[model samples]
Target: MPQDDKISPRKPRRAWPVAMAVVAVVAVVAGAVTWRGQADDGAPSPDHPRNRGTELVIAVGDVAGGEFDPLKGWGSRPAQIRLIHSSLLTVDKNIDFVGDLASDYSVSDDALTWSFTLRDNARWSNGEPVTAQDVIFTYDTLKKDGTRFDLTFLDRMEARDDSRVDFHLKEPRSTFVSQLSDIPILPAKHYGTDYSANPIGSGPYVVADYQVGQQLILEANPHWYGQRPQFTKLTFLVLGEDAALAAARAGTVDIAYAPPAFAGQRIDGMTLQSFETVDSRALTLPTLPAGGKGKIRTNDVSVGNDVTADPAIRKALNIGLDRDQIAQIVLQGHGRPAYSLVDGLPWFNDQVVFEDGRTEDAKRVLADAGWSDSDGDGTVEKDGRKAEFTLLYPSDDQLRSDLALAVAEQARALGITITTKGSTWDGIYLDGKANAVTWGGGRHHPHQIYEMYSSKVIDSGYNNMPQYTNTTVDGYLDQALSATTQDKANEFWKQAQWDGQTGFAGENGDTPIIWLLRLDHLYFVRDGLNLGDQPIQGHGHEWALFNTLVQWHWTS
Candidate 1:
């Protein structure tokens, strides 16, 4: 199971008081007045040069409803939160870490303490200096609230001065700096429980106006320390996929997040941009049985799943599927076949190779394992037990549905019975009785390996859905977490995948998961709108499309 930051979907909160309603209405009226002042030709008025070629409308799939507090807010609303706040560090289009609020940083020789120096010109939107105390406050608040991030290793955070802060960790973690990219620093004095209603940050944009379920208006922050944004004003229109497509076709929206299925459609004046992402669709094979009935035991829990428990069977299934055909038919050529869960990542093991479907090789492996079509019924049986299992996928996901059917057809040719069923995520995954399920996740840190395959989290329900356990795997992951340098840690991560003799794909190791394909994010941009180059996306939400929002410009 992949460790995802996605929060469960929640309904939009609607408890605007009378005073806030009045303020919202007045803001609308003022906006209307300003619109009326524009020239009839839709050009800026001579008296208002600030409004010249400075407005843009973007159509998103959904609206964020909850508070913007990083500690309490869900990961689903990253677009809104990212625009209104600033993180200590940020990732560029190339997925490299870069300084955002902090100008530079250094780590001690022991790799347990990190020190950062803030830029002299950095300030909040309110013209107040962004000091080290604000960072300390944000971290302390989140630590106290017990946020989702695993911060138990943190020992203390102290402000050495107004512009300098030091963080001490109990153990060395090569990926600690990358983790900071997800935590936004808030203004110590202005931020509170209700700060989402009126967020004030040091980002390039400031919320000028907001209407629940309608739209959000952003104005340039004059006190921002980075390069000035090209557009002086930006409006995010809240709309669904259909409405967003309609808006794009009607020339009402400057940019829209287009679904992959609709990416090739010819919109009048829009150009579709496709970005590669770490988002993947894969099948998780249970190493343990649905119920307690197997020989393997951990924490007094019995593990079953006799069919997949055999390393030979798991290896046969891994190489028995035609991933290229699945990528072409199911993904419609929008993605590439995946052999590893963390494909294209820096820590991925490039030496591990998976061959295409080989019916003869698959049969040979099963025969050596004592499975044969003894009854002439076209189904393999061993020890009076049939080689079959139930594979479940979310009923609402067509991609998973198609892949499930494709996998079932191929497995049947090898005398393995795979029954496909369409079920809800809760009915299968949450119930913890699913034999197999289609799963995916996105993360910048290699710790994701531990989240999915570590024995420590097998029963925690947060990850390790397969209940996979291997002493060697656990040792490699533990050493990686404590490794003093990234290069050294990266070698451990690669070895954990496959080290020629023992690994996930090793002859004696359990291949608990089978990767399929990587999903690509698609979007439609109105002609002449330069959105700059987009970076490779990780497996989070869709807010990554706005990463280059400040650099967007209109030529027409």
Candidate 2:
């Protein structure tokens, strides 16, 4: 969900430190961020476009501690971790692997070994040259610590002198390449237990100070090897949604994470920036019977929901509800009506999409499946079993709760009784196993498909919450992971969802989850700041905000 919370490293992203002089940029900045600007105080207002302020202060929501650490799953999402540190490889918005710290890379004929050539000019913020040893150490630590990226296939890593590194794999796991973009490299000599608090890396900026519950201040790294940033100093103020909006209205900050609820608000020096994201909200229903025996990542966890386990009910729910209308109503028209987890992505099977709002169609499917409202009551039943279930959402999350409530409203029309409840995640896992729980799943990589639909990760952390299992889907996932080329893998990933015959999507076969809508990340940036072409943001809003942070500059 936005690694805004450490709920899953799910979107733990990157941020870089800056040390620009922002006094002329805005009227007021919080403590310790005083700046001596390049222009005089009496100069024409810097509020207009083309006024290149030396400093930038932003009011953001998710700058929690430990998120700055890459080894601990920080860079897994599209966050600021990439700003302070560089990975050997980086992923572009096109979902293609490009070089970051490493400039050139290739794989062996056997596909068991991958190698990279590091950039000669890259150096740490601490004035030390970044080396292959650092890359090796970073990956080694991630493997040992069990990070978000899968590295079990790693046999070992070797460095060829200072500028090159080679990764030896236990198998021809093609997914290993995707892992390179998910991690941020760390310097070997200085990395320690307290590294997250005091990090040293080779990104465009360096962490100057982070006052808990207050703000994070960053300064430009003199030793940075990339293009020089326009703003030298970066300040991140941690404020609640309303509080950040207030600060934005006051013109005290350059940018703020604008809540969709208040998306229509207008501010004098600020303009709204909407980013389409893979971050989505959906309902994962249990596919087995009540009290059924199943394992969740090697550990036994009860999994079942008799009512939801029915394919008819799932298929009905998939096509019955008008998700497009819901996206408009619930998301303030900022989100896309999501069908499959990866809708517009390359690997997604567009066949999963159906003309929603067909409540009569949903009823017809249910009636054919022997589910009918024979009773005087509005709810349907089959064999004396009522078609009823509870949908749970994290009590604190308003958006998910809204989605749950909205989805419940539509499902009820189909004669499927849906009762919505807001509860803690702990309580959901503890009791909602057999019940439908609203889930968050979206990312740039096709592996997100593997994680959600693949049998290999059914019970693994946060993936396959419905405990969905299909031999055909499993085989497709395995083939995707093993394919030597990305094109072949993409094909298999699509086939797993809907192979034109039988697959996971309800239209074709089974539907373990009622795919809902993807959230749109909205922000209020000061006028004149051009952020350039932004990538479609993924699960982490905070991490993905600055996908092209360096390219952001003032416009005339």
Candidate 3:
């Protein structure tokens, strides 16, 4: 939903390798390791020790291929890439961007040019000094080869000296620095077409051994400039959910990701850790017809249901639902009620709150818009057209299915008829055929709002799924991107939500999307393992659990 997992090349999402389908199910090993001195009731102990381990075993859903090519081998293997390579910038536990290979960076007055100075002592795993040339080579290679990331905004890249590199941009972009946090710098001299197989990097850890479809072993990098990892070895075992849970129960794995369904289940010596996420589940509303206003588009399409095209109908749907009940019943209390696309994030605007279950207000808005229950009929109708639309949800997602049913029931109480139906991702979202569908998304940066709601992204093939178009929304998003400082940019983002005239919550405006709740990520950790502070997660990947690997330790 963050556009990072979509397979389309034109879209902002990352493309997974075709081999992922073959490795979805892996065999579980027999005879898991058993440990003694288990905690009572498996609850975390208050007197647990710290920094007492030389090795750790973590169970993951999948294994990364031996390939370590930063340009070609990412998305599908984020954990491996992050451990083996170092980016110019990195985000801390607070989600704040900081330098990794770079010592400092500066932006020009017009925001069109940025310059970064490399840390003098930064060296690759092979003990070669990381220079500005490596940074330039990485950027130039990505631009020339057309990597998954969109770097078209860059005009040119130049290295002023061995320690400095400058980037000139075609347009001002406030989030450019944040985006650079994921692009790892590679050693240009050692890089080849097959470099992914034996990659060298400047990160704190290096790949020691790799066994395809089984496990990967990581060792501390002797030449790392930062604080060295305490653990001498880290082994990541490939396992499915059931297998991971089995391993955790038997004390074979030090850490494993757990879903909400495993909430009450307790292991003999493990602690369940829950962390907040920015990811949210919402419903998308169509604002325009499928076909162009006058001409035909690439593919033949039909105009969406006219009932949802009305702004009053969308507004009523937004304020008419009891989100708290949905969070309790649908999510089993694992999530919190969400009011906007970015409810828990720092940039989220608190002023645009929606009242719960305002059935009377919803009825008045629909009635004012020419809808009436004529002839004492329960359903509202105007000019022989009934207020009815079909709500679609993916057939396989239990959470979405439950939410759809709840929404339909609430809409019926307000004189609106909503028919719930099951649909596949391709059937409902590929061409935007369904009237309304449950949507998912969340991003670490506030630019996500511009990508999903701006009129400019309607034709971008990723977000703007409902074809929402507004000149005022586009202007505000542009201003947010061009702002000189982050504080000023945050104000512009808030304005895009509600500016008292033409925002998503303005008097005359109807929101194109309805938010429900933010899901929390759960994990099972062994009693002695101490994972450092973790930041709220975004939607794309699950590898963020090991972001603080350097700080992880075990107690006796």
Using TM-score as the yardstick, the better of models 2 and 3 is: 2
For residue 130, model 3's alpha carbon misses the true position, in angstroms, by 2.8
Best by lDDT: 2
> Clashing residue pairs in candidate 3, if any?
3-13, 4-14, 68-196, 69-196
TM-score of each: 0.80, 0.86, 0.78
Q: Would you list the rank order by TM-score, best first?
A: 2, 1, 3
Model 2 misplacement above 4 A: 1-52, 212-214, 292-302, 423-432
What is the lDDT ranking, best to worst? Answer: 2, 3, 1
Local distance difference test, per candidate? Answer: 0.71, 0.77, 0.71
Per-residue lDDT of candidate 3, residues 231-253 (tens digit): 87887776656667766765556
Candidate 1 displacement at residue 439 in angstroms: 1.7
Model 1 per-residue lDDT at 418: 89
**Top TM-score prediction, candidate number:** 2
What is the alpha-carbon lDDT of model 1 when measured against the actual structure? 0.71
What's the CA RMSD for each of the models?
7.9, 6.6, 7.5
Cα-lDDT of candidate 3? 0.71
lDDT of 2 at 488: 84
